[model samples]
Target: MATAAATIPKDLSRLEAQAAGVLSPEALAYILAGAGDAGTTRANAAAFRRWKIKPRKGRRPRKVDLSTTILGTRMPAPVLFAPVGVQTLAHPEGDLATARAAAELGLTYLHSTQAAYKMEDVAAANGDGSRWYQLYWPTDDELTKSFLRRAKAAGYTHLVITLDTTLLGWRPRDLDRGYSPFLENKGIANYTSDPVFQRKLVAPANVAPLPAGIIFSGVFQNPGLSWDQLPLIRSSWDGPILLKGIQSPLDAKLAVEHKIDGIIVSNHGGRQVDGAIASLDALRPIVKAVGNELPVLFDSGIRTGRDVFKALALGADAVLVGRPYLYGLALGGQAGTHTVMQRLVDELETEVRKAGRRSHRSLSRSSLIRTP
Candidate 1:
């Protein structure tokens, strides 16, 4: 018997088909599942559908400039590849392929602290392209410092500190599978590379399994972290720092008080809290609270070009897409990922012209109409 070929569609729908063909049911569920009843996940998409673009006439441009500079770095489009962990489970190349695709497209790629590939490997693959590092704030302060030092040394210009997931949320799929990829040694690149983390381990030569207590200790030990610790991270890192997982307007105000470079308005893709407001719903107020003092980026529930447009119109300077690209990776590795990204850029460009806008600069909240 022979394995079936993974189907590749010319568009985003291909990603769905490819995922179906290539991914096992467990893998698919792990990637796609949401928290609790999954109402928030559905709400994220529904929010995008609720906002319709208000097109203008006789204002089309011969060329549309999709490029924008974010935190002193130029990106071909406002879209960035958001950091997601444990790619090896989806594809053989893992983060390396995703980095290559982002580099080729001249877009920013955010590499997760929990990436299957180490920071240096992804940075090397990036090769002068724009790449940012996402940190999970390890239980050990020394381990955290070590990861930041390595990221800075690797030429990653931006550091995104993910404030969510200090504790993992209720994910039914993972629960059903008895699956936590982290426990399987999947998304432990930064940890495995950390001198501090390694110090806690028995000698590598001995090949003894890490004690269950030790494993749980590292996993659940970050609850003492507080907002005051932002200064500690700033003191250790020497680049632009972004605070991810911010949702409230008040928190947005506080992030500016902390003097972070950017704020990612996110709800951990509704994975952390089930009834939390959709990221799209939360973006405008945060942008308003920051009041142009800092860039407000957004993530969660972005699926298509129109969704990107909706985000920008609502107040996001740029958008981070997580699962969509992962779907592409699961389906076709680098090519699949590249196609999905390009499709978004292409759609945005088309929609821009159709709406009589030449650049992202002209897009405003006025360009969107809310559903009745």
Candidate 2:
């Protein structure tokens, strides 16, 4: 007897609609909305439609291996959860649920510096799961080093330093609602719980709302941070440090010269700049510029498995998925996120089979054909 595959929604639109049913209206806007007119956000997915995969039928590999050890870590698939903060806005469990889900699936869970749950708590929930920490680079030197030290101690294998979002883009939606998650002191778990941040406090953080400047430093960015300052992290951390939010081929080349271990060619998921270059379009140039000096991961506008395929074909070593799993978290918590990732991995497997490739790594620019 032929067994049926577990039915999950293949269409992301359908899954998103389901997520919306359970999520607050404010959260829906925050997760889905982008900067300014949001041209870049929409374009991120639409740009995938521009490239077509040239498949080889009736030539499937004897066995398909979606598992990748390429990142020098044990990731069952190349797809990883992009570091998104304020996950509590989607569900009560927040980063813990997402982390647990990723751990169960043997996927890497890269959590945000501004996550609602403390790093220690999220790590506890993950329970031997592969995990990574992301940094937003606060202005204070000791605070930054404090973060790096804590993550290293907490069993995180990789350090993903976000390069964009130094000042935060002019996000019209968040501004219109006058909702600054940081100002509300939401998503500052990693900061507020840290000794360095606590020592500098004039009074208890809960006594009164912090000034905007403190919130930015204690939870988020330092636009003044520069290339000369990057070595601080390299010197402090022991594991591979990946710079996320790289876009330019020139900057990608510079990243290599700077001795960055890896670069994620992203534009903050089109949230930082309106009319930013679609990350997919920028991937080729950056890959060409740096070649194989370091791993080039891709993010921004990865909604489907075919989208994942396009990124791999275009030269992305792996792809980061953000909003989709967030949507899943909004809809079903840990189970929801697990289901969403499983579907995407299943879809990627189907893509690999259809392309007649043994694994995602074998895919290259030659596997694609540009259509007029």
Candidate 3:
């Protein structure tokens, strides 16, 4: 059965331009710009353009099905709102707007460990919407356990352990402007609200009095983190575990060996590395490594429905959208977020049908061709 057309402005380019008027210059540049010289950032979108779909003709009159299930949770599209932190910089409502929007759309949203609001509040906004918790893996064991415990209690269905960012990367754009959201205590509501983290607070906790790095350094990134520590998180979070930022086939295989539930093929949306390979370029091998064993959620370089379709064809079970919805939120709040996401789903279903595929799960490498 055909669904109604997307209600809001689905055109990303137009929506983004509209957002520029609504957001601050610092916020605008921060979300759009990438790391270092931004070569890999450009490459993410460029890589998609290099590949063309080999259209299959003479399809039957059957309608395409965009419905899919991940970890047994059924969704209307093979898409999820990726965990993008510090959303308060984009909108006052922050993760709450996102949570409410996802719930209304029946879409799955991954809540960031560093979200601006407390996890419980975001969960309340979700109101039975399927959601996952993305863990940054704080160095403090008890603190980490506290976060996991709260998420499980909040109705989060999965745990996404982000593994690649042991330390923040060199992003020239943010550096040039002396803009760091953490330093402002913008996205640490989850941490600050935590009883464990609050107990560690000393000399009073305020954004201006102390830099976030000073307080968060110990807990933010554990450079020494390795597979040895995976058990710690596993023991804490009993639900499904997905290790985000697995770019290599070896890492994908290792995750399977570690008995992980899924791996998000990402390069932190070209924010972590300067000259890294495009995430889509890295997806094929990782999928080849362990696509059958666990779900491979692809992130980075996804701006449109065609991008989502291309990622699905390349091997991702589902794709995560990062910045676009934030742009929408900047422009129109919860309604904007819903419109952008729904637009992507609308476009993805349109792409699946155009490529002559019945279901998104049926999309394969044969559906696309890499152009020279």
Candidate 4:
């Protein structure tokens, strides 16, 4: 009889393969797809290998401090669940299971605008856990305000507005299967449940999938969105605002100039842009631009503890992990999600201790050397 550990592979890649075996071909493709030829998606992982961690020769610290606070949220570790939508495809519980796991672990859970479950229900599932709301700004101002109001009332204390996905990317995998969960009303729980959105529906019968999906599609993206609209968000939600999807130092500088609370240096996990710069390669320059003016969070291509370590050394205050945990959720639901996160946190502690350091805070560019 083999133990669970003996049966399940610890390698993240193998874990993803296991998940692929469990998920439907359509679901797997949607979860795995990157824009166009996936050039940037591939680059995100490659950028991590371009640097080598430099271990200092000295007495190793017996304990490492992984705790950090971002935008007033106290976390046990500097990790947050990246807002992945349509989670029901991986598991029936979807965001509900992930929310519970985040609560148990005391890590921040970022609820997606396109979440499979309603925000209020997900919040309830999260219990007293710290949660941040990720908004995919809609075309309607009232609907946007409604989402902000609801999230705040539901106990979400921070606002993360994704800036890159003003328009959906040309995802070949999703397109190939003609499978967009949103079109099927799979990820529109937030919209369907919203009072503002409901009022826009011509009739109660129109609230069903086909009609509601059309309404959702109409307001989902605002490609004409501009910097001038930031004030609307500021007015609608009274919380720390973090602008995600920024990869350019100029944009980071602009975020500072706009008085935004923080910036997440990302490229939407390479789902938005095909040949965009790897988010890791973009981190240092953006951090250089922002300085200590605002917190700089990182995402995209973060797959391992060493990846988190590298991001911190390059100047990210924290990192948002996406694919790895979702694969865990696919494997064993909530327990698997918790296990994957714990492993990452534990590995991060190991990395800090082995490098002869005691805290992630002590890591800096000096801890790594750029490789050829």
Candidate 3 yields a Cα-based lDDT of 0.85
TM-score of every candidate relative to the true structure? 0.94, 0.94, 0.94, 0.97
lDDT, model 4, position 320: 98
lDDT of 1 by residue, 1-372 (tens): 012113344455346555766788767877777888787887888888889999788857999999999899898899999999888778889899999999999999999987988899989988978899998887777777888889999989899989877877788878988877666666776776667677777654125434522463475447677887877787899789998999899988988887889989988778878877788898888888895899999999998888898899898999999888888888778887887888888888888888888897689999999995
Highest lDDT against the true fold, candidate: 4
Clashing pairs in 1: none
Q: Show where candidate 4 strays beyond 4 Å.
A: 1-8, 203-207
Q: Of 3 and 4, which scores higher on TM-score? A: 4
Against the unseen true structure, what C-alpha lDDT does each candidate score? 0.82, 0.84, 0.85, 0.89
Better of 3 and 4 by lDDT: 4
Least well predicted 10-residue stretch by lDDT in candidate 3: 1-10
lDDT, candidate 3, 200-267, per-residue tens = 77744563335444677668977889898987887887888889998899999999998888889999
Number of the top TM-score candidate: 4
lDDT measured at residue 102 in model 2 versus the true structure, 0 to 100: 91
Model 1 residue 224 CA deviation (Å) reads 2.2
Error of 2 at 65 (Å): 0.3
